[model samples]
Target: MGQGETEKIAGELIRQAVMLLMDRNEDITLSSVLNILADFQMRAFNTGQLNACIQAIADVSAAKSGSLREESALKDKVAGKCSSCRSSDNVTTLH
Candidate 1:
């Protein structure tokens, strides 16, 4: 799947999970979200979608555990900006 598609699926899964867990009076941790996604994987979601969803959850969890500023920075990264510098104009490639 393309990066944009992956991000969209991941974002949707994360958003809904937060809502569902809130309705159930449960905490919406990364693991909880991942389990929800995993259950969906067995029935409907494909492997690629599941993987992307899990990755996105992990990223959010990691950022949350760190500084609050990192959360905004991580969001920028989600938007395809460089995590270190938050720039999309300059391209960096490694071989």
Candidate 2:
């Protein structure tokens, strides 16, 4: 199957797994969840199938930034402070 199709399937599987865990009042760690998905993939699909699904789910849930403006701003602020002294020297000015 195509990458998109694989990702779609993986995403659905992850969603189902999440719902199942939630329904059972179970708290699953990332590793455990991945193991469960891997098992499901091994039995139901081919290699890399489960990984693709998980990636798809992550892609959907993860935040998307159109630009690095926020990151840059934070960096600018941090750049003003010295790592050792925490001093804002003239050369370390933010602006």
Q: What TM-score, over all chains together, does every model reach?
A: 0.49, 0.45
43 Cα displacement, candidate 2 (Å): 1.9
Residue ranges of candidate 2 with Cα displaced over 4 Å: 45-95
Which 10-residue window in model 1 sums to the lowest lDDT? 86-95
Model 1, residue 50: displacement in angstroms? Answer: 2.0
Residues 28-51, model 2: lDDT tens digits = 645446655656656655556656
- Which candidate wins on lDDT? 1
Clashing pairs in 2: 10-53, 11-53
Q: Tens digits of per-residue lDDT for model 1 on 66-91? A: 75666767676666576555456652
Could you tally the backbone clashes for each prediction?
A: 0, 2
Scored by CA lDDT, what does every candidate get?
A: 0.67, 0.61
